[model samples]
Target: MNYVLALFLPPLSILLIGRPILSIVVFLIWVPAIIFSGGLTHPMFILLAWILIYQAHQDRRAR
Candidate 1:
């Protein structure tokens, strides 16, 4: 679900993945990146969100 969510809302997905601080930071950068770069940088944030989501899942499994 988060993987799908990341496509459209990476920062929200990151927050859902349990990275409040990083999500705030990403939100700060993502908005401008999306605006100034004409969405060219969106995929980067999506990828970052996906990685964090995956890591969170892995951490849960480890525990």
Candidate 2:
């Protein structure tokens, strides 16, 4: 679920994990990075969002 979202919208995926501030920050960085790098740096943010989503899910399971 989140993993697929992360591929297309990393910041939004991060938002789903409950980090509003971080999501805003990621979105700010992501938009420019996408434009400036011509999407080359996108994978980095995607991996980050995916990791955050995974971690959040793991935390929920632990609770």
Q: lDDT tens digits, residues 2-52, model 2?
A: 534533488888888899999999888887777677779877998898899
Q: After superposition, how far is residue 29 of candidate 1 from its true place, in Å?
A: 0.4
Model 1, runs deviating above 4 Å: 1-8
For each of the candidates, the C-alpha root-mean-square deviation to the true structure, in angstroms, is 4.6, 4.7
Instruction: Provide the lDDT at 27 for model 1.
Output: 83
lDDT of 1: 0.80
TM for candidate 2 is 0.82
